[model samples]
Target: MLLPAASTVFFTQVFAGTPGGVSPEQAAATMVAMMAHGAVGAALGATVRLSFDRASGWLRQLRVTPVPQTSVVAVDVAVGMLLTLPPLVVVALTGRFLTGVRLAPGEWAGLVGVLWLGSAVFVALGLLLGWALEERAAGGAVGIVGTVLAALGGLWVPVELFPSGLRAVAHGLPSYWYAEAGHAAAAGRLPPAAAVAALTAFVPAFGALAAVVARRRSLPAVAG
Candidate 1:
């Protein structure tokens, strides 16, 4: 997290002061978007971990323990949420001190809080993939999946830089809305209704799908 934040700050510094230099506000917005990207993409590891546990029969072993399956799943998602903090704090600090982008303390808190909450969509996605796919397949797919989501979501390049058609497509993605929410919060405003609605819809949709997959996967163990 620190490494990525440092690299972004370095790039922002290099580009500052030129004719087309990144403005402080743009840099701040980019940092906020990147924070959301890192938070959502962080769950890719949970996919791999879940796949490995399933492959190793650890999930099956857990069935014999006293802990409920819902508890196990909740713990995994909660851990993913916790993972978002490091990147959020690192990038917030990097933008504040290194890049000279300032936000009120309340704005910073709101920014972090929004991105952290929106991350549930992808965390659920990671869990769904882990539960649904083979270990080797999940491992191979996660990197490509994360990269594609980030690219299309406008984290790697600003949507403003994209061609018109691509920009239209970006508006439809949950990742795009996720970043939009970050941008809004960083600016000390409520996230757009579209962003809030998109995130609200995805969270439960992905979570329900993941839950269904987990229940299906556990059925064989229960019957055995």
Candidate 2:
């Protein structure tokens, strides 16, 4: 989430003027990218933690309540959004003060919304990981998946920094779209509406998968 270390190399890279004549404005874009990545990464962690509860038979207990499984899922998705905010605040403040970044109020709000909404995509992924993997394995999965997604999606570095083929592949990931939405907000514009729309589309896609997995996970317990 872009922690501050006034003398550290990481700090220098982000706050120092961008190399190769990249402008401050351009460099500032990472603020949004970091926000999206940090939020989604944290959401993944939360999902893993919650999954342990499910694995331990916490969620299956709800089967008697007559709540549509989708409703339970909706709640998890909302919780993921809530989880994104606090870390986002820390990241925003750190990026602002540590880097001396400035943006309009609207821009700040836009980026926050973009990251918050985009997080649902990862949260849904967390659901799949949670249900699919063993409880202990899900813990490791969060780290592995976060690292891979970050590197491939421009969450760790700018997509422009990639070679052509890699960048093409990155474009296909939902993480890239999330980063794009955040970067566009940082640049004081709306991310492509299509990208935002696509993020919305993923909620249902990922959510449905999670729902299916979650149901399967519930089956043995219900049958008993």
Candidate 3:
């Protein structure tokens, strides 16, 4: 969770006097971006854990237990939402204490809220992966997908550094919007409407797709 924050510190220090050195301000934004990346990546655990649960037949058992499918999914989503916060809180603290970021109280609250909400896209994505893949494949898929999302979304490297074509492509990803939304909130502004809309659209899009896939597989029904 803190690995990305730590790496940001290390890289900023290493390049402090170089032409490529990051400004203290940009470093702070980068840290926030990395935090967003970590939160979404952590949310991917739902995929691996659920795949294991499926392999163990726990989901099948739930079907026989009279549990409302909506209750089951709500619990899973609630757990995933909770899982995202530790990194957000700790990393925000590190930014304040270690990196000397100084946002207003409202800015802090807005930033946390935006990032937390943005993670819903990945949480829904995790459920999709969970329903779609076997346990053995889920872990590797999460690793690859998370890394690719981070890289392409400009979480690891700024989109400013990308070629024009690639930057255009990055602008289309939810992860890119996720970090952008965080950055906007951290700077004391409402998140960009386009970003918020894209993320909003993706949650149900991924969710609806997951429901269809799960139904086709004859797994337990997933509540929307």
Best by lDDT: 3
What's the CA error at residue 121 for candidate 1, in Å?
1.2
For residues 1-224, what per-residue lDDT tens digits would candidate 1 score against the true structure? Answer: 86558766766876786788988787897688768767766866654478778777788888789999789887888887788778878888888887888899999899989888888888888888888888789977888878888899898788999999999898878889999999999999999999999989988887788778877774234233
Compare the candidates by TM-score and give the number of the best one. 3
**Candidate 1 TM-score versus the reference:** 0.91
How far out, in Å, is residue 195 in model 2? 1.6
Structural similarity to truth (TM-score) of each candidate:
0.91, 0.85, 0.93
Task: Give the residue spans of candidate 2 off by over 4 A.
Answer: 1-22, 65-71, 218-224
- Model 3 clash number: 0
In each prediction, how many residue pairs overlap at the backbone (N, C-alpha, C within less than 3 A)?
Answer: 0, 0, 0
**How many Å off is the CA of 100 in candidate 2?**
0.9
- Where model 1 places Cα greater than 4 Å from the true spot, the runs are 218-224
Clashes of 1: 0
Report the lDDT tens digits of candidate 3 across residue range 104-164: 9988888888899889999999999988898799999999989888999998888999999
Of 1 and 3, the candidate ahead on lDDT is 3
**CA-only RMSD, every prediction:** 2.6, 3.4, 3.5
